[model samples]
Target: MQQSLKTAGVLAFQRSLYATDAQFYSVLPHQQEKPVWVIRHGIRGTQNVNKATEKEFSNIQITDTAKLDPTAEKMKVVFDIKFFDLANSLFACAKGKKDKEKDTVKKFRATYDAFLTRAKDSHGLKEVVLRYVRNCTNGRWLWRNLTLASTATITVVKNDETEHGLSFDAVALSRKGFTDYTADELALAELFVANLQGYATDRFRVTALLDFGMPGVQVYPSQLYTSNKPKGFARPLYAVGAEEPVRTVEDVMHFQATRKMGQAALRDDKVANAIRTIDTWYPDYESIQRPIAIEPQGVSLELQERFRIKKASAFEIIQKIDELDPDSPNGMFMIASLIRGGVYSGE
Candidate 1:
């Protein structure tokens, strides 16, 4: 009789799809210039709803606001992504209980190897890469910024080679599904698959550009949390700038800056989350009709629900991954989760 597989006590995977923090730039209708800081100002508000008394209604508050440069006609967001070898990206630590350490380790390796072999044989990696490319071309990474743009164009340049790049109509692509693709989108997907599968000499640098046509529209950046927010401020935004003192309300909205460029930016993690929003395999996906970010538990914070309940989570499936069909949705999700990267130790 064959021995049943046991889970590894220390299993970890590194992120295969690495992205850099996206920087913002102000642009004219058809011109490129240095990055500029989004405008920061104050807004006055009055308490109206649920006011306790007449005096409460008169209570006014001041809050900080950030917007794009009023003088510019368009806003440009630029970021880069690097693809890593996903098949051999496991990072295992010490094995399980001493008595079964050797057996557990052996089983773990065999199971993982089988999983990768099946995935590669079935071309599962290509499907995942194509979905990632769909998200990139659709401007889903823009988050709130996507809603503001009347028209948007996304350009994907490999290794900064602008002459050999692909451009897509960001606004035209549907975010609700990933079933349709244009010829250019497929070409981009092929490039990604080639780089990820080690067909390229070196790791490819995928730089993405989002050009929005709205003039002076407000752009959103990753917001920072403060346990004790300054007076008259709603929230703080993530910024890269020189060390300075926070003296006023305007100072709370620190914009990302370099010696020559000042720009609003999104954190790399946020960009990564957007790029991996390809979890349509979740249980609720049929009803939701949209994909959520690939999470270990199939978590969708926006919906405040965990779609993968009970034995459906990546943690549960990974233990018996070798038993799963690599072409199935669940198997594909597990592979994507490994690429997404996280600790999945049984201990």
Candidate 2:
């Protein structure tokens, strides 16, 4: 794992009219000085909810881990319920086990209880957070990055289809899910690799937009909408592929925590701490978070690329965008799209 507390920090980027990069920067320190290679949680794109009864929550069994597409790169991976249920089962044991110690049981229950309360009562919490994502507004958009500038887009994304190909293979996850998105607003029907009938599968997630620190170039208008927005631009990106299948309650819990903590490790040391907490609280964590396979950013022809224009000097890109998409009645939007998608190959 080339990533570190410092290196992963640099690559962690978030965009929103509501959230600042600094807040994320503060959460995850940028000691490595390289763009962090991260993918958000891609939940199962289904409206159906997996309402587990109390009985199901209490019983959890081990399952197989999801594999990665060996031949694919830049492919969006999805998670399964085997992992989620594994997490929930462990926690249930920690908090509900009659054989556990009082203090240990209390602490575990407290954590789970706190999480449940927030999931069910985030509206009240938002009153205290002022401008937080409060509810799982756009759960699909979670973990997606925006194109702040057009520096490496064309360069990295357009080089070859091989780098973007999707391969289906089993991978080991340490402490996270397919993407860094997790919320209850929508019940994502994911697959359970360990299930008797499923293999490697994820869900479809929506795309998002982002900004680069290019000078004078405005990535978009002052006001933005998801429909007319660029892909990977949304803070909490949506869209996912088909889910594997749900076999148990443990799958849901592990999937949920993994999705929440994918980028979380890079977000802050605290997130790592949270992982430890859950690990201790839940012992049967091996099933959901198998051996993780995240790659670290490196110095390559792609890294050589730089933003042709900077946020401070954004005149060039912006001027070109306006020229092409004149904001006029008949002007087309492809010009801006070209600029937005154009990769800054300049070193």
Candidate 3:
């Protein structure tokens, strides 16, 4: 595995927007540079929430270890969970593109104020378990329960450049030490992460994205199950033909994580795949003889032939969208539908 820094100091700074790329540079002080190949996870798409979750699993489980785990001991049962980037829905409605500046500001302030009030707890817990609802039985993996209230340090950014007019960065770290955690807890945590990494590598072939220092280009995750399937569990009766099925609580966690990663991959991959296709066809967007239209979503392309443009006229069609209309929808998203349905130059 390519070596990368994974110290507590580094991990703490990972969520800091102020942290520089130089701070995360992988080169060791005395070691010589070595070239290596890396597989990339596709960008998270808005539509493929399930797929996005998988990508994040691969990211945290596989890439974090192969490239970032400095301690020989695999990912500890105790790990940091950052909530800032993860909670997109909480702030999405605070500022709509069509909303006036004053209205957006008002919405943001009110929402944040209410959120802060509700979120604050004297006990320092953010999540709660109702008496009627059953919680996870295992203490080792309690952090996975999205409902548990773990102490978190939240960073709120207010600036003109930041998205949603208001932004937040929250991190919840497992304070328990390895020495204190029971053997079953540690083993279960390790097995769960390892399985996720294996699922990503085998299904999507995203070793490059999991590597350090790779380009930000997005890659698409596959929904198709790999022939080399996850073993030790039998497929449930209701989950027939499902590439991946939830056989246990651990499996459910992995399944949910994979969905989040898929959403992220879908959003990111649309543009990444589009740029790749256009670059391959025209060498660069600037070099094209014909002007190409781009929606905020991305260019149109295929998964297997991601570098190949779906149609020469896709750009022209998108250009004809009613830009003057306040309610006009932008060009179509270029990830799932484009990949599944071939494009036609003819309208």
Candidate 4:
């Protein structure tokens, strides 16, 4: 009889997909002029609700905001993505101490290899890549900004070669779910998969340009948390600029120090989360009818719920990879979780 194997004690995988901070720019319609950098502004207002003992006491609230130039008719968001080799056989590590544990680790490695092979051979990786591409083309990364724009155009250039790029109407694409794709979108998705499979010789750069058709509108950027904040101030939006003298509460807001091209930007992790919001395969997906970000246990912050529990969790599926079908939803989730990368030590 064959001996049962235990989960590996120490297992870790590095993230394969890397995204840079997305910069915001304002451009004039039907003009060839240089795009203007969106600048952050300091605004002051009075707090509506009174948390103090005195009902008449109103506190001043200072915050940061960014808006497009008055003459600008379009808002441009630009970001770069880099793909790394997705072979877990070399990047993922598994360690064991005793004889039985060593055997279990060996078996775990074998199972991972087998599953990876199946994923490559089947439609697993392609499905995941296509969903990611859909999210990018649909302007889902814009978050709140997408709703402000009446229309959007998304252009994706592979390796900075504009001639071999793809463009589409981002607003027409569905944000709630993944569905049909045009020929150009499919081509771009194929390139994404190729880079992930290590078929490309160089680390290809994929640049995403999202042009939103909203004139002189407010644009949203990721907000930075304030610690030991002033008495009356709100969280500040993320920006890149030089450190100026702390003359007021707004001066306490965070900004990246730079002499040139300083502007409000979205964090890399935020952009990555947007791109990886393809977890429609979770248990409650049928009821929710919307995709959440790919998480190990199918956690949705907005819903404040854990959809995948017990046997449905990624950690559980990973231990029994040998029994999983690479084409199934759970299998695809596991593959995506590996790509997201984290320590999965069963200790």
Alpha-carbon RMSD, each predicted model: 4.3, 28.5, 25.3, 4.4
For residues 163-244, write the lDDT of model 3, one tens digit per residue: 3221111122222211233333333233222322222111111001112122322222222233654442212111111133
What TM-scores do the predictions have? 0.87, 0.17, 0.18, 0.86
Off by over 4 Å in 1: 1-4, 38-41, 48-53, 57-64, 97-101, 201-214, 243-262
Poorest lDDT segment (10 consecutive residues) of candidate 2: 4-13
For residues 177-226, write the lDDT of model 4, one tens digit per residue: 87787787788778888877878733333333445454567778888887
Q: What lDDT would candidate 1 get against the real structure?
A: 0.73
- Cα-based RMSD of candidate 4: 4.4
Q: Write the per-residue lDDT of candidate 1 for residues 3-99, one digit (tens) a residue.
A: 3456778778888788888777777545755564533445556666774576664434333234556667677788888777666578774585643
Candidate 3 versus truth, CA RMSD in Å, comes to: 25.3
Q: Which residue segments of model 3 deviate by more than 4 Å?
A: 1-94, 97-102, 122-347
Q: Tens-digit lDDT track for model 2 on 140-184?
A: 112222223222111111113335422211111112322332332
Per-residue lDDT, model 4, residue 204, is 36
- Output the better candidate (3/4) by TM-score: 4
Q: Residue 255's C-alpha lDDT in candidate 4?
A: 53
